[model samples]
Target: MHSQDKLIMIYGANGYTGRLIVDHALEKGLKPIVAGRNKEQVKQIAEEKGLPARVFDLDSVEQVANNLNDIAVVIHCAGPFSATAKPMMEACIKSKTHYTDITGEIVVFELGQSYDAQAKEAGVVICPGVGFDVIPTDCLASQLKDKLPDATHLKLGFDSGSSMSPGTAKTSVEGLAQGGKIRENGKIIQVPLAFKTKTIDFGNGEKNAMTIPWGDVSTAYYSTGIPNIEVYIPISPKGAKKIKRLNAFKWLLGTKLVQNFLKKQAGKSRGPNEQQREKLKTYVWGEVRNDKGAWVTGHFETANGYELTYLGAVAVAEHLLANEIEGGAFTPSKLVDNKLVERLPGTGEIHFKPE
Candidate 1:
C-alpha cells in the first residue's frame, strides 16, 4: 500500500488509548486522520500533532459511512462499545471499509461476529479485540493448539504492569458490572465476576488470579474448538477479596443510579502517567490441556500493557493495509498468525513447555 493510500482514521482521537494509537501510527509514517464527536478536541490534537482532523457523531451511521471514502481502515478506540460498535460496524460494512477495535467485551465481540457474512460479502474485515486484553491470550492459545493438537481446555493468566490507564479501568469496571462468561460443554455460560481464583506461578512468584471475562473466552472457542476456556489476571489478595465482595452487589449494576455512579467514579480514577508507564512491566502465562491429560504452557512479558496494545494495533493495521488477511469478521486468535505474534515486541519472551 502506498503511503498516501494508507489513510487511517482514529475514531476516539482525543481519548487516552486513541492518542497512543494515533502517535504510533504517525511514528510509523502513516498520516492518521484524528476523528471524534468533539470537534475542538480533535482539531487541537490534529493541529498539535500536525495531522488532519474530522468531526462526526457516532450516532449517525449514514454520516460515518459517507466519511469512509479513501480510508484504508478505521481503528476504533471509543469504548463501552456495547453501545457504539454496532452502528460503527454497520457504517463500515456499508462503506466496505476494514474495521478493527480494541474492545474485549464479549457482547460486543459476539455482535461483531454476527457481521461475518455481511463483511465477507462486502470484501471487508471486521476484527475486534486486537489489543492486549485478548491478543496475548489469543496468540498463546493458537500456539498451544500447535503443541497440543488435541487440547480441550485452555487457561490464561497474566501479571499486569502497575500503570493502568483510565480506559483500562473503565473496561474493567464495565466488565465487573456486567459479570463474565466462559465456554462450557461447547456453549457460553454466564458466571459471576471473580467467582473463581487460582494461584499462577510464572517463575517470578505465585500471584493470585481471578477468572475474568476476556475476549479469548469467546474467540478461542471458535478458533480452536476448545470446549473450555478461561482467562485470569493476577491481583493482590486484598484486591481479590474486594472483587469477591463486589459480586454480592452485582444486582446494583443493572440500576441506572449504580451505572451513573460508576461513570462518575471512573471519571475521577487516574492511572499512572507517562513516566510510570515507561517503568511498568507486564507478564502473561498460558496453559492448554488436552483431552488425554497432556498440557503445555507459555510465558510472556512487556514494558506495559498499553505499549503492547499499541504494538498489537500497529501489527493489525499493517496487516489490514497490506490486505494480508482474509476478508471477514474475526478475532485476533483466528486471524493473526502465532509466529507473527511471537515476533511482535514483548512477545519474544514467550516460552512454551509441554508436560
Candidate 2:
C-alpha cells in the first residue's frame, strides 16, 4: 500500500471553495490529488497544479470507496451536503479513510456524529464543519464551556463581512426550506424562521443577530455537554422581519419550481475574489450561562468566511496527517483543539468577559 500520509484527496476540487483549498494546499508545498464528478475540470486543475487526479461521484458508497483506497484523508468539499455528505462519509468509513468537509449544515454534522462508533471501529476519523461553519464557533463554545464548567445553556453568534459562495448560497436556500432549529435539553427543536433575535456585542459594537440553524447547534452540544444551544448570525431588524414574513411562504420555497429557480440563481455567484477575501473579516461570539445566571462571553475575529474555510480545512487535514488522533466522528475543535481557531492564519486573540 502507498503511504497514506502522502496521499490526500480533495473531492470536488473544481468548486469555488474546493479550488481555494487546492490552491492553499499547493502553497503549503503539498501535492493533493484533485477529484470530482466533472472529469475535465478536475483533471484540468490537477494538471495545472502538477498533481494527481481522480474522477468520482457520490452515487454509491461502494463506488466512492473504490476511489479512496490509498487516500489517508478525503476533504469532501462538494455540497449541498444534505445530499452529498452521506455517500462520501460512508465511503470514507468503508475504505477506512479519514473524512473531512466544510459543511455548515446541521443534518450533516448530526450525520457525522451518528457514525462515531462505526468510524472508531473502522479506525477512520469522520469530522464535518472543518471550515468557517463551525470551527470558530465550535471552538468558542468549547472555550466558554471550559470557562463555565457548569454552564447549562450556550449561545453563539457570528458577524461576517463576506459575501456568500455559490455553495453557501445554495445551502442557505435549502436551510430556508427547513425553517430554523436549536438544541433544547439535548434535543433538536425545529422553530420558525428568524424565530428569535438578540443584540450581541461581538467585540466591536452591538449587532442584531437572529437565530439560525447553524451546525454548532449539534456540534456544540456534543462538544460542551450543554443541554441547550442556539446559534445566531448578524441580521438587521428589517432583515429579520423580512425572514419572519418568509415563514408563511416557506412551503412554497420548498416546491420544486421555486427550489430549482433559487438554486439556479445561487449557482450564478462566483463568490469573493482574492482581494475581497483578504479584506473581509468574520467575528464569532459565544456566551454560556449557568442556573445561577452567571455568564461568560467571548468573541474572536478572523479572516473572511471562504478564506477561513480553506485555511481551516487544510489545517485540520494537515493535523490529521502529522498527528495520530483518535478515530471517530468529531467537531473540528474536538478533533483538533479549542485553540485551533487562534492558530489560523488571520485570527485575532480571543476576548472574554465574565458577568
Using lDDT as the measure, the top candidate is 2
lDDT of 1 by residue, 23-131 (tens): 8888888888899888899999999999988898877889899887767789888887887899899998888778988888888878888999989888888988877
Query: Residue 170 error for model 1, in Å?
Result: 2.5
lDDT (0 to 1) per candidate: 0.80, 0.91
Residue-pair clashes per prediction, in order, are: 0, 0
Worst 10 residues of 2 by lDDT: 1-10
Residue range 210-267, candidate 2, lDDT tens digits: 9999999999998999999999888899999999999999899999899999999999
Per-prediction CA RMSD (Å): 2.0, 1.3
The TM-scores of all predictions, comma-separated, are 0.94, 0.98
**Any runs in candidate 2 off by more than 4 Å, and if so which?**
1-5
RMSD to the native, candidate 2? 1.3
- Residue 320 local lDDT, model 1: 81
Q: Model 1 off-target regions past 4 Å?
A: 1-4
